[model samples]
Target: MRTLALRGGARVAVVEAEWTDAFGVVTRGRVQLELRDGEPGPVLERDAGFWLRGTGVRALRNPGRRTARVRIVTPRTRTVTCPLPNTWRNEMSSMNDSGVVARTSHTSRLRGLAGIGFIAALAAMVATTLAAALARAVGVDFEIPDGGETIPLPGFAVVTGFFSVVGIVIAAALLRWSARPAERFVWTAVSLTAISLVPPLLSGAATATITALLGLHLVPAAVMIPTLARSLRTRTD
Candidate 1:
């Protein structure tokens, strides 16, 4: 058990104990908790609760008028694994399988990869919409040089194709070369989402640009996370 003292103007990053499951209670000071990004962390705050377990509450800081104190605890287990049923049987069958079965399974993986490509393409489309909304707000009258009139879907497709491939290249590098596919995918998604926001800032548009920009952020996050997570899944298992 460890005790923390938060002075009149002190802050601390909530930490875990030797055995993490021990839990915590805010005995004195106010503790504000939320997920933190690389910058400008979560806009909201949650109170202390049993969520100290698996919840990745990035930072906990003192937010009280007077001094406060907090108690900390640790979890009992370091790691846990869940085993699947009938997996050994499938492995045995694969050992006795021929080229035809092997080739088919490999093709299935590629098909899933293609679906991800389409999703990335869709992200590009939403990004373009956000770009337009932002451009209008800035009063710069921004548009593709030869955009002609109404926004073209093919143009979005072409742009989506390019960026989607770029995102794929990034995710593939981690999935193939890195040991932690899920971790790498999450970080990459965050970076890409932030990078996607830069264009709106550069746009001349102003009003509601933030709202439009946030909407656009969800588009790619929705597209990338699910597709990337699915790619890591094993259907044959």
Candidate 2:
């Protein structure tokens, strides 16, 4: 195992071989993965990861001005333990970290995708509660209880949990079967969010109520799409 760091603005060329690995975690700034065919692969935000395998990719380039760090392993069978600087070390660790062969992204991206999406959805749910509180504190009493006469905090949470799980299920399914999971996820999420707005729109609430509901409609999507997309970012780490 060898560690390789790319300083800001540095670029690396891919070598031809049966299989080669350059595992990278964003140590400081962003790094853009580019294919030889000139496609945008992934954006490694701080602590985000990506990989360069075989000669499929043309080069790894530092898109940001700040230093970008990466590690390389000569033999793909060695166990790797180090984490990307600021991300969850244990959680972000991958199958490759155990020195085992893993399937390509084309075969499936869902193995870990659901967990990531769920975490993001959890965050979004909490954010919704805060947003509601903030709105009420400012005297924007835009509450419209469709399910009951009382504000169901537990019910809200349950619904959030359910929708989040739905997002995860969709992600996992697409990754296992679809070649373009990110793109597919984005469209699906957008369509679902739009469809969800219909119920709230016709609930006969005030305009402000409708506006607030729309905001709520987009909350899950705000979290789910990015989470799914990040999960699709390939990494050998």
Best lDDT among the predictions, by candidate number: 2
Clashes of 2: 0
Candidate 1 lDDT tens digits, 1-237 = 555666644555546443144444455634445344523222111122222434455555554345556554334434424221254235324542111111123345446665675676676667666665565566533342343343343554455556667766666655443434446666777787788877756654443544554555566566666777567433211
Error of 2 at 178 (Å): 0.6
Error of 1 at 230 (Å): 2.8
Winner by TM-score: 2
Q: Candidate 1: minimum summed lDDT over ten consecutive residues — where?
A: 96-105
Off by over 4 Å in 2: 1-109, 142-148, 235-237
User: Which tens-of-lDDT digit does each residue in 1-237 have in candidate 2?
Assistant: 555567756777656452244454555545556676887555455545555554366666775445667554444646757633443334335534323222234323355665577678788788776765665566555656575353444555567778888888887776554435557777898888789889878877667767776786677678777777667544112
Model 1 stretches with alpha carbons more than 4 Å out: 1-111, 119-155, 209-214, 233-237
- Cα lDDT, all candidates: 0.49, 0.60
